[model samples]
Target: MKAWFKSGAPWVWLNGGAVALCMIMVVGLLGLIAVRGFGHFWPADLVQMSVLDRDGDRQEVLGELVRKEVIPARVARTNGYTVAEDVPLVTRYLIKQGNRDLGSDFQWYLDVGMGEWHYPENAIVVERREWGNFYGFPVALKEHGEVISRLGDEDFWPEVEARVERSVDLHNEIRRKEKVEIGSINHKLERLRLERRRLELQGVSPEEMAQAEEQFAVEREALNEEYRRIKAERDAIYEQIERDSFDVETVNGMEKTIHLHNIVRVTRSNHLGVFGKLAHYMDRFWEFLTEEPREANTEGGIFPAIFGTVTMVIVMSIMVTPLGVLAAIYLREYARQGTVLKLIRISVYNLAGVPSIVYGVFGLGFFVYFLGGSIDELFFPASLPAPTFGTPGLFWASLTLALLTLPVVIVSTEEGLARIPSTIRQGSLALGATKSETLWKVVVPLATPGMMTGLILAIARAAGEVAPLMLVGVVKLAPSLPIDGNYPYIHLDQKIMHLGFHIYDVGFQSPNVEAARPLVYATALTLVLLIIILNLTAIKIRNTLREKYRSASD
Candidate 1:
């Protein structure tokens, strides 16, 4: 053992252990994320279970339960209310309020054929066939069951259409009332004008004209008063109707009524059977990465966040790569090691260690408020006071990340440059090559592997970064895509979605945190996979560069 230790086996063991630990950690993280994430995408059936409450009379009050397919209802007793033990019951929907044990009151049965489940307090049944949502409507089919059209499985379009038709009728009625009032006012005014004309033709005495004028004035006053009254009434009716159209209370009431017919029946899909499943899985994947802003879950899409992350990362890479390479080149070829250079190097290193949040603050103040605000004033004078770039946006977020990861690329490129031999430069120059040509053709190519290494590292780090992006461009929900149909097309000032931000939003910020946990994991896995794909591509390029430069280095 002493000999082995002397031979450096102890150090080898220590290094090996560290390497194994790191590998384990990475694999474990990936496995956890994948299991959670992919599990969310797995095909699920809509399982109907029975929720029961034990009344004070010891009789059970049964409640309708809806859940994903095949979820076990393992019961446990709780404060007063009985819930399905193993069943993942959505308490918000089933039980309005109560702390009750889940095990004692409710039982679960898996029902495969029937869309509804009714439990006789003693037995609960659950079952499954393929189920999914289509055009914002939940749908299902029983195993080997014929397609049947069930009532109330249509989109909010039906309700919206009904509301719109009613609205049109109401609007016409209002317009009719407005026309009647306008006609009445016009008729009275015309009558008064006719009377005035008659008096004018009669050449009445001065007192008579005065009294006629006074009579006309009183009639005019009454007409104005009547018109105002009619206008007020019309406005009140219109406002009330408009308010009711978007009324939360009315909408909720309608939703509940519609939900009563929210039946999931076995229907033949327009898509082939497996295709439906695939589509369903993709929808779940999208949901894992994003949340719908509306109850219908149709108004929002994933393109915004997808575009934001891609655009920002690409923009950041563009800004950072050349600057990093240039700085590294200058340091390696021009600057001599001295106090000033050392101090500069130390400063660069220290900047990398600065907390990312501090960068966000700096970006908010300098990039957003100062620089962006200045540009807005100079170029967009018409938009005075309200600066476009001064808002939190993709441009600022990308710029912040560019600054944050500048050190990584710089350090890597410098190390790559340092690795190239002085002999190669001398040989190139001796061969009558210009300094720029030699540096570009020989040195840079030799250092390609290292440059890619830096790029890969930078990409990985940037992809995982959330804090700076949060303050700069990320939003919980973006109303518009980063790239859209608007003028100038790419709206850098618009807020964007990010996968990392989505994970945080679903995991910690969601009202239903526990239910969203699996979704969070899936989103995280998707991000991890993207980073891995990027790293793999970089590695492939690095290997190619290394092979190409093998002879040059030797």
Candidate 2:
């Protein structure tokens, strides 16, 4: 037994080490992502705070904060948080008591105004003067604990709801006034039109007729002026409605209303009381990769990134498959061993070695600048100096990646074609099968698994690529979605968001670096998971093909 073990020991050791290394790498990546990215979904206790200004224009505040000791089973009547049901079992278990909707749970803000620093330990905020805050207008809260639990009470939330409703009523009143003014303007304009008709038919002297026409024009101008004012007034009222809402919290079982503007700092779960902090971590783990992109930070959803990556892959596959297969067929079957074939092989091999960034530069110059510039000049003359094709976008970026990965597809297909036993082709020819049919029916099927393997590698590499995409398609912030309602509707030229780019933007471009670091890790984890999903899909295809063709290949 020892002798037999020794004989197979080298192979066992090599395989075991490889497996261990792969496991370690995967575990380390997931751990980092869990700690940083998904970990942010938990709730923290609200810290009642107060601020004092040197001038003291507005002062004095008192309120009692009320909260629940245990989270209710059905706190929300509507849909709860967007946690995926498909995540690891452990993640599901941890999130049982976590925040149902993370967005409404956690709260943080900052204040740096003129005065000696007055950082009160825990102060109940009774009323807010304005909606502005250090954490911007919006904030998040946790599901459980005193603050969020108390939020469920009708008495606790009635004032905030009332304020919002009052603001809305004010806006509606302003709109009603504007509508009346507009109606008056329209009536006057209609009367002027009738007067103009009468003047035209009266056969008055030309000079008098012209003067009356001028008076009518003056009335029309007055109508336009009044309408503009009405619109402006409506807009102002709408803005007022948006400025009235804010977040509330309970600290030490006391209800405290922190005015948005008075908020001075934002701390993570560390400052949240024990259970509140635990809930935060639990939510982070539970959310994992399942939440829709819409639920992400103000930066935007991960959906766009997911869509862009998948769309690019599908487009690249559609484009490269035919070209690659054709090139492979010619090289393996039609082309004889000669200088041309040898040169072609060398070029294909060399193309694979070129850096991906170079392809991006080439794509930007040729597809974007040259071809796209020409198209823009002919069709989109109205939107000048901003050529659609000349700018970086998904269409051009996908094309660039397709070019970069083309060699891999061709090489794989050629290898697959080469592996077909000559006897099969000979037998097909002997049985009156033409070369085309022989290649299609006999060779292609057997080679599918290998070709699929190549495609998988290409997708894995392309999905993770960021540097090349940066030059051609990625944008820091996209106000409108990539696909929008506009002329030539597809809008392939529009820049899109991506997870990799999101990581870069948050990590490097953010004004609050310390606050954004965790976000960067979360984005990175999302990108990594996206790439893994793509690879897994490709692997599934490869497996299916392998199963289908196993008997034939054997």
Candidate 3:
């Protein structure tokens, strides 16, 4: 044992154990998150039960069981609940009775006061475009406010499904028209206004200005014509959606008509087989990936946050790579190796340790205010006082993240450059190559893998950053994507959503805590997957470059 300790075997074993423990911890944490989040998509059976209300009367409740926990009996008693004197613990439930049907989002009930639980086969669970979910029993299918079919009729469920499918298609069509087609028209009209202002700022002659206005008027008239046509079509769709609705009866016998247009999903999971449950799960997960968020980000999908996160990371990577590589090349290969260079390198290293929020503050002040304000004053003066570029936006956010991650890149690239054998440079010089040629063609190529390593690290950090993004560009919701059919398609001036910020918003800022909890886990898992994918891509490129260079050298 003493010899083994002296040989460093004991230390090696300790290190290995530490690594294995860390791996277990990471896997365990991921497993917990996955179980909690991914299960949220699976259809849970509707539960019907009776619980003692605040007034000591038994009231029927129907919905999904969110969670249950045991608490001290004293805690329950303190909340104005009656408990037996001998009971030491009380079990309580957080029942998601649903807002649209129960007039409550969720309620806490003690198990002692609850009656027997019933998994009702006839219960219906509804996911809507707004107002969260509705849990009730199907009463009848209606058309034009009249009952067309009641339950147990051969055509009742099928007809309801058909109408729902039709409504969904119409809703998607109207959304496309509003968000894409008419949105494009509005963007173009704004461009025309800006262009005219630009020409005016340049002090164009009256003839030129009048000619521009004539062309602009023609285009504007055409856009308005198209806009009106789209609006009329959407209005027709709206009428069609309103034509179908279904009546639902709560367990307490309260009836309400739910418009088909408002419904996004309908589930009767009590009869779902294994495959049926799997299909339902996949459908919900896909919708969560593809749909836009609704209802304070407590419902629907997080596609915007995903898109924005990827876009910001890509933009940040693009801005950082060349700048970091160039700085590293200049510092390691060209700059004088003296005290001043040492100071500069130390400053870069120190910048890495600076709190990220400090970078956000600097970016907001310098990049957004000073630099962007100057650009607006000089170039976009036509849109002045409105401050076109003088705002926190995608460009500034990417730039801020680039700055935050610059040191890592510079350090990695410098190490890559330093690793290129001195003999290789001498050989290149002996072959009659200029110093710059040898440095660029030989050294940089050999260092490509190292630069990519830096990029992977930068992307991982930039993609998860929330604090800096909040000050720079991230918002709880963005009206539209930064990239669209508009000219200058990548609108760097636009605000964007990010998965990290989305998690923060859903977990903390959401009005519905229980609804947002699972979403937080799901979004967190998504972010982890995204970062993994990005890092894997970079690693693949780096490995390819390293192999190519190694084979060439051999």
Candidate 4:
């Protein structure tokens, strides 16, 4: 054993075991996230069970079994529940009885009191636009105050499905007209107003001002006409959606009228076969990826967040790559090897260790308040008080992140430059190549792959950053995406949604904790996947560069 230790076999085994353990942990965590996140989209069979309270009153519970908890008997007793002293542990169930409109939310029941469980084939889960989900059974469908169809009728299910699909299409149409087309008109009108204000502030001649006003009036009148037409079209679709309604009966026997317009999905969990459930899951997962957030971001899709995150990272990469590469080149290739260089490198390294929130503070103060405010005062005086570029926004957020990740890029690139064999440079110079030619053509190309390594790290860090982003531009909910139909298309001045902040908001700031839990997992998984995709793309490019420059490595 002593000889084995001296031979370093034990140390090698220890290191190998440590690495294996880490890999296992990482894979296990990713697997857990996948199951918890994707499983939320599946249409779980709703269960009906009898639950008894401390008052000895039994109630019929119906909804999806969301969670189960096992607690020590003393803990349960402390929560004001009466249990036998002999029982050391108490099990409880949390049912998502999500009839929020009916003054119902998720409810917990003691496991000791639960009697019989049932999964009714007729029970349906109604995903709604407002007030959360509705767990009940459809009894009848109504149209314009008339009973169009009754449940159990042969055509009822088919009719309901058809109408729901119609509602969805109509809803999308109305939203596009209102939020997209109409919104574009509104944006144009605002820009016109700002332009006129700028002219007034500029002290333009009366004739010139009058000419500008005439042009503005023509454009404004055209926009208004289009807006009116689109608004009318949207209202007509809205009316169609409101025309259909359904009567639902809850487990407690109370009847409620739910308008078809208010619902997003209707799923018959128990009756759905494997194929049906898979289709439903695909539909739900697609919606989660493509739709805008609703219900304080606890429900609906996070398309906006995804778009904003990708856009910001791209913008940050654009800003940082040149800056980081230039700095690294100067430091590594041109700078004198002196104490000053050593201190500069140390400062760059220390910058990476600074608390991320501190960068947020610096960004807010220097970038937003100082630089942005100056830009607004100099070029956008007419939009001054309103701030324009003076506010925290996408541009400032990206710039802030670029600053935060600058060190990673510099260090990685500098190392890459150092790895170039001195013999390569000597040969280039000996072959009558100029110093600049040797450095740029021979050294830089070889270092491209290493620079990409830095970029991957920078992109990964920038994408997940929330603290600095929140101070600079990220919002709990952005009213509009940074990119739109407006000229200059990508609005750097606009606020944006980020997946990291979305996770934090849904997990901690949401009003409904239970609802937020599943969403948190889903958003987290999305962020992880996004990072993986971005890193893979960078890695692919790096590998390609390495292949092209294989002689450098050799």
RMSD of each: 15.8, 15.0, 1.3, 1.6
**For each candidate, what TM-score against the reference?**
0.63, 0.62, 0.98, 0.97
Tens digits of per-residue lDDT for model 4 on 1-554?
Answer: 88988999999999999999999999999889888988999999999988877677888888888889998999878877778999999889888899887765888788877788989999999899999998889999999879999998999999999998888888888888878898888888988999999899989999999999899999999999998888888888888999999899999899999898888989999999999999999999999999999999989999999999999999999999999999999999899999999999999999999999999999999999999999999988887699978899999999999999999999999999999999999999999999999988889999998899999999999999999998999999998899988898989999999999999999999989988888888899999999999999999999999998886556
Candidate topping TM-score? 3
Q: How far is candidate 2 from the true structure (C-alpha RMSD, Å)?
A: 15.0
Segments in model 1 whose C-alpha atoms lie over 4 Å from true places: 10-14, 45-78, 81-283, 286-303, 485-487, 545-554
Summing lDDT over every window of 10 consecutive residues in candidate 3, give the lowest-scoring window.
96-105
Better of 2 and 4 by lDDT: 4
Model 1, total clashes? 29
Report the C-alpha displacement of residue 467, candidate 2, in angstroms: 1.6
lDDT of 2 at 181: 63
Whole-model lDDT, candidate 1? 0.61
Task: List model 3 lDDT by residue over 1-554, tens digit each.
Answer: 88878999888999999999999999999999999888899988888899996568899998888989999999988888888989999899988888554477888999887999989888888788888988888999888988999989999878887888898998999899999998998988988898998998899999999999999999999989999998999899889888989898888998888899999977888868899899999999998998899999999899999999999999999999999999999999889999999999999999999999999999999999999999999888989889878999999999999999999999999999989999999999999999999988888989999999999999999999999999989999999999988888889999999999999999999988988999999999999999999999999999999999888866
lDDT of 1 at 508: 82
Ranking by TM-score: 3, 4, 1, 2
Instruction: In angstroms, give how far residue 481 of model 3 lies from its true place.
Output: 0.9
Instruction: List runs of model 2 lying over 4 Å from the truth.
Output: 1-8, 46-154, 158-240, 246-300, 378-385, 485-489, 549-554
Candidate 2 residue lDDT tens string, 112-225: 121232323332222122221121111222222223324335553455435544654675466466545665566577557756755665678999988997887787898889
